[model samples]
Target: MGRSKSPVRVITAVVAMAALVLAGCTKPGPSLRPTATTNPPGVFGPGADGLGDTYYPKAGNGGYDVANYDLDLKYDPPTDTLTGTATITATATADLSRFNLDFTGLKTEKVTVNDVDAAAEQSGAELVVTPATGIATGAQFVVKVTYGGVPKAFDEPGLGEIGFLHTDDGAVAIGEPEVASSWFPVNDHPRDKATYTVKIAAPEGLAALSNGAMKDKRSAGGWTTWTWSETKPMAPYLATVVIGKYRVKESTHDGKPMVIAVDTSLSAQVDAQMAQTPEVIDFLESKFGPYPFDALGGIVIDDRRVRFALENQSRPIYSSAFFEAGEDGTWVIVHELAHQWYGDSVAVNEWKEIWLNEGFASYAEWLWFEDKGEQTAQQTFDNSYAPADAEMWRVPPGDPGKSDLFHESVYTRGAMTLHALRVTVGDDAFFKILKAWAAEKAHSNATTPEFIALAERISGKQLDQLFDDWLYGEKRPPRPRR
Candidate 1:
């Protein structure tokens, strides 16, 4: 939960600070191996469907295959009342009659396995089921769980906790776990991402929302039912739910629909503060390709989300951090949107190669700056920021043995590595290399070495030394003459 609690909440911020300094660690499951065809000797592609595929063969009994979900959930901030139902479809990777799903704050009232009441066990937020009939390997089944509780959190808040505290403000779903199942039955982690069809029932006039698109809505029992479906497969952390007294702001950018939902305080005037989004998106599409979703918009929630933005699919959760007037936001915004291609669509195989995401997005920012009258963009490349010492390459971010995703070495030196690549390949071919890299591997993870290979192959130029010196091994290149 890389979110930092406020100074007022300093005592409550035990794990927040540590988590921020160390961006946590998340690894994809083993089932994520590329199809034999897509798996090249030196490269592998993303999930079959683009959203990441996480498989933990030994995490549970026989492992689990999370296919999809029909999630119907609700929370009453009035009494901190949490209630919901989820129909989870999954397959048994191996022969097994029982399995577990993480649900931190949520309580289970009823359980059904394939349309029949079944014996279930509840331990903390985990729900385990013993099917009446032994389920076989690769056999698909349905699990319907209905329950509600005061949504709780894990040992860490933002990383694996589901925040469902009923507050004076409203109820919000801050899911980062393969742990959101505490509030809803879910596979939890990102590599296990699946198509989610969510339904939320809340008091009328209160806005109910979830990830993806809003399909249908109706009032039931003085509570409004919200049906949201994201056909795109998504990890549980990315599967989000938020309900509160909202101020919805609507606008159109480059012909695509855009919406910004905030609390009542800024609902009426959220647009003026977030006006820069369209131009930024247009600028990106002109270079990177399309926006990479059906629509694009922002969700500037309360200050609790801390710094930066969570690029949550078509709708990213932006904190008040970027709402300021004329900050150095161009770099940050471009970085997040570029995640639509790098981190979101084509995710990393594991936490170790986060440089693949951060570096590419940061370099995209420089490319945007270069487009914004920075002398042909190559000057930005020429001025790649780094220490002159050859040894700087060896000292990457994170501790010597422990890797951190946001270390300055990874940020600055990582960006500079892209610059060094451009310098090696020349301008015209450099841009072509980028376009080809993005186009060919549009929705899959790419390793740093794999990227180097793609470029080396395309340019017919050797790149082992480029990746070696700048990325894996830290040795700054020779300083340019003044």
Candidate 2:
């Protein structure tokens, strides 16, 4: 049965490497067509309430494709409040009478469409907006929403807490599967990719960091505003903003920019682990393709509560504890960094297709260690198949149910699927497939079927049964023959 038909259950990773462990973060509007009173009617209607994502039925809205998100936010640590405006520029795919933006908790102060006042209301996580006038299809529209409130992090049933998480000094946005809405109004799904400009202003002493390269910084009235921009298309889930007292370090690796923000508390240990950032990027680029984004870096927040790290576009976010753990921490760092290509660059179209993200990143850990001569991908794959983990076989990587989005199958079994494919296609073709997949699908969303088809085309072999038995089948297939 499809995930949509099934009732939502509110219920609910380790990797071998002997070291590596598993861990597990809006909107619209327009340069809209000027509202018209006269009708040239075909089917002028409101956009779909949801994008109809199988696992996340309410994710992403329909009827429009977002082009860019300009988020101007001010975070006051004293009050723990985030005040800001989200200006979205998008093109309407259909004649839209109204549309919805995914947002939760934050208070909406004002909303505008094409610079005109529009009516807005909150329905669950959906911020439904109705323009004063109907928008025509093929017209570009602009929406600007001003909202403010104490940012709250959400405990996503099985996915852990995410959204805007308060830290010792300030707050960091972690949590995944879909938490961007908690901080800012967004389309809130992987299918909608848009360029982003995040401008954050915080108190004088506190440092605020976000994704991509830092474009500019200005200070006024004892407050500093940092501006960061990601030119490449990005999904909402990959968006991030971190504010705290951090020892911000910047360097260059092979002409690409490298920046690492280590929490002041764990600066010593984090600095050393972060020194490997350049090497990690170079290593992955050698295997996957040229680094997918213009900049490469990360942010380490000082918080033990945030046990897992997030792969946030050009810059991944980490818990300070992750760095203090030593080699295992570095391996985890590599895993998240690898996602800059796998998850951030080659995004999945639906939440159900998350194996495309986690699986690739998990396999990246194997590849990184393989390069270090510590272990082979084959050995890692073989080790993951212990009888103790047999229950993981109950659900294939392709579909692990809604609540099990972060199950071990998506990571271990998902990586195993890739290794199996490598053995079936040979090393040369396998690497070619990896590089091609990242290069071709860079900054766009993709599905499991698209990957299967791409693999078949590149290797010039039938991989249907192979993907079927490994990715979709309930029972695990016999080990691949080398």
TM-scores for every predicted model = 0.77, 0.91
lDDT of each: 0.57, 0.79
Q: How does candidate 2 score on lDDT?
A: 0.79
Q: Which portions of model 1 show Cα errors greater than 4 Å?
A: 1-62, 122-126, 154-168, 175-182, 250-257, 267-270, 325-330, 374-384, 387-403, 442-446, 474-482
Q: How close is candidate 2 to the true structure, as a TM-score?
A: 0.91
Residue 68, candidate 1: alpha-carbon lDDT = 88
* Local lDDT at 219 for model 2: 95
Question: Which is the leading candidate under lDDT?
Answer: 2
Off by over 4 Å in 2: 1-41, 325-327
Error of 1 at 428 (Å): 4.0
- Per-residue lDDT tens digits for candidate 1, residues 1-482, read 11132322321221122232111112233455222123223332211212232222211122466778888777676877777788889865545545666655566788888888877777654567766765565568898888877766543433332355343566665533233554676655444556788888888988877766667889978888888777755556555666777776666676656766776654433455455667777876776666656556656565544454556665666555444433333445566676666566655554456666656666676676667643344554444443355333566521222234455555456667777777787777677777666666544444555677788877778877766767765455553221
Model 1 worst lDDT window (10 residues):
15-24
Instruction: Give the distance in Å from residue 299's predicted Cα in candidate 1 to where it truly belongs.
Output: 0.6
